[model samples]
Target: MPLRLPPLPALRFFEAAGRHQSFKLAAAELNVTPSAISHGIVGLEEALGVELFVREPRGISLTATGADYLSYVSEAFSLIAIGTQRLPNHRADRPIALSCAPTFASRWLLPRLAGFRARWPTVNVSVDTSHRQVGFPVDGFDFAIRMSRAPVAGTAWTRLFGERFVPVCSPAYLATLRDERGALSLQRATLIHVNAASEDWQAWLDATGADAIETSGGLRVDTIQLAFEAASMGLGVALGRKPLVDSDLASGALVEACAQTVAAGTAYWLVSAEQADSAIRRPELADFKRWLVDEAARFDADVAVADAVADTVPDGHVETNR
Candidate 1:
């Protein structure tokens, strides 16, 4: 006994035609002529003894049977794609390309990427730091980290972490801003601003209810990294983003100028192309995704514990000699 089926090429043409609802479009996608698509679908109908398309003067559409059959065909192709990707030696040497914002790449990812390399030394990774939105597969990126308030359309994404902004400055710079009673005064302080996050100061002010402070003036820089450097050099106070500034804060290179942290209303997300059958199937991509997500989870857990401890401490409580 043998399996009965239409020609594979005919089925391929039929699936593409059914999906696009136009022979011209399907032909373009398959890099063939419209006549080839029409003939192929006709041959497929003749072989199956059933019409799969309703041809009209303007265009073509899937028949009821065609619509149902398309579902099966699409699923079959998807399974084939998944299976093909699982094959050994399937692009194992290809490096995993990633795209993300420059600030995030420098401040957050680069610091932690060594851990990933240590874990999966065989998988090479190339990172592109660009703020421009990229088209999947076309841009040649297997993964991306994006900061956004809403999900990007036509992609699968996982929330990395929400952002919180706080004022930070070098210890020496902060010392100049404190008054006799040890209260911070911002009236005479120079505000450092990042052009990419122009509204950060205003947002922070509104969240803290500091109506007297004006945000019209500042040492504006194009990048958050530069602004941080300027602040670390004791130039002024920079609005620091968590996780990015975590290392600096821990090292005592930068300290909170004030005690307020405000939600940024946006979060970091790990994104991959919506049609990611091939990329997602790769072991290297899978390992990298898992490692990145686990790292973010651990950071979140640590932040939660620190917040819990901070909440328990009474406000304005100071330690003194007994």
Candidate 2:
């Protein structure tokens, strides 16, 4: 269908001038010269075959026709602006889709996600659980949180934090060990083994000189988070990541079954393709990136404080026994 309408620029100039009651003010608002606004209004009035504004020696005032036309034009512009605002949120609802390991998502990211939401109310996020690293851009994911020894190829990576592996057990299980003399031994206690994190348990055992304890002989879990849950339920001791267990320890739901901690070599990373060509239209990715980095920084700082507290423990403290 052929649509007949006045030139858009002319309508804009008339609406602005009518709203302000002065061409000079309309020019300033539109970032145009007053002469331009005046010409546009003149062209518009000629097309409409009516005077929109009556120019006076002092300034200008809208005529009856201009005032009536303005009511409609102003409403149209307001509607356009409101519609534009809702578009980004429609895109935001898809969320900045991320692929991450189930254990890390459950133990670390999920626990602190509320803070991310508070800071970025409009940027939605969804986490995909997989031990396998998904191909970036190819998989169409906006980001991936991974525990990796090295960054995946074709993607830029930012290290979030390294992990320290330590043995953790429920408070009930720890109560059974308070009476043990010298080094606390877990020889008889059931050990929780996560197939994916066997190395962490092996590292902790090696560091604590508990070489005789069989790490392979225990209930095997598929994920580290489940292992922590098992340990928290007084099922057995689980090799836990320090950052993941911080809240549990603080809440007295879990405690250090052993003081020995070993660096797990792998670290958590935020990764994405270097070029944002795939999902650049989703501006929420940038907001999520900045927020994740800020949250990671705060997490590292909190871990540092915990480390300091552990170091400054008094001689009679429970940690001193290890």
Candidate 3:
């Protein structure tokens, strides 16, 4: 029997918009426009003879019909996988499809991956680096590490760690800081900035409350890992995350330019949805999450150690001890 369905283009648009709740954002993801998504949804609803979304002032929401239809679509995709598709090779036997933020993956998870492998030698982990929420039905991803200000609703979520941004550079950069406030210090050096740190320098200014020199000029990088790399290579001071550079600072690859660091007003979480129960489900995800929480606990300990170390020494001590 020949089967017929609405065009996948329309379904894809609706799926993205429904999941994100903003056609504008969905458009960004789809590389389309708000009007295009609205048109596509209109076409889809007309084809089905029912509206899939309730248009709202600020954004769209699932209507009762929309929500019910979504559940069916979600299950249909799952059935497709279970009924015919091959699962991602078993994590215990192959790579677990792990998703994470690029910076977090590079600076944090990669450093600890070997340990995850050592603990479960049979388990292999593959990482995806995008700063967006990926759900299970579309892709067979086993788990995702998401940076969210709030817990990811409708998923199993665990608090990973909150972030704090601090200015970091090579020890050689700070050697020139002959003054207590590091005054006349960074002005001579370029200040590399990253998009994630839009508020970082501003917050540091608040923390230090100084106007001695402008610390806002240097090589601009699009990615945090690149910024850290530049900072390590003597390019300029980079604002870095606590977990990302804790190892670097301890190893002296990078040194703090300013003693004060401020919170980034966001956090990260490890999430798995209900579809996580598929046969492709790997025990290693649970294991990895437990390991991550413990790792975060150690970072918390490091923060405490850093604070105590900072208190014992004065603000402009500049010795840069762990």
| TM value for model 3 | 0.69
For each candidate in turn, the TM-score is: 0.68, 0.64, 0.69
Candidate 3 or 1, higher TM-score: 3
Please write out the lDDT profile of model 1 over residues 159-178, one tens digit for every residue: 98887888899999988886
For model 2 the local lDDT of residue 48 reads 84
Candidate 2 C-alpha lDDT tens digits along 219-248: 888877788789999998888787887778
Please give the RMSD of candidate 2 to the true structure. Answer: 22.3
Which segments of candidate 3 are over 4 A away from where they belong?
Answer: 1-5, 16-94, 130-132, 175-190, 211-219, 233-235, 250-253, 278-282, 317-322
RMSD of each: 11.0, 22.3, 6.2
The local distance difference test score of model 2 is 0.77
> Candidate 3 overall Cα lDDT vs. reference?
0.74
* Best candidate according to TM-score: 3
Alpha-carbon error at 54 in model 3, in Å? Answer: 14
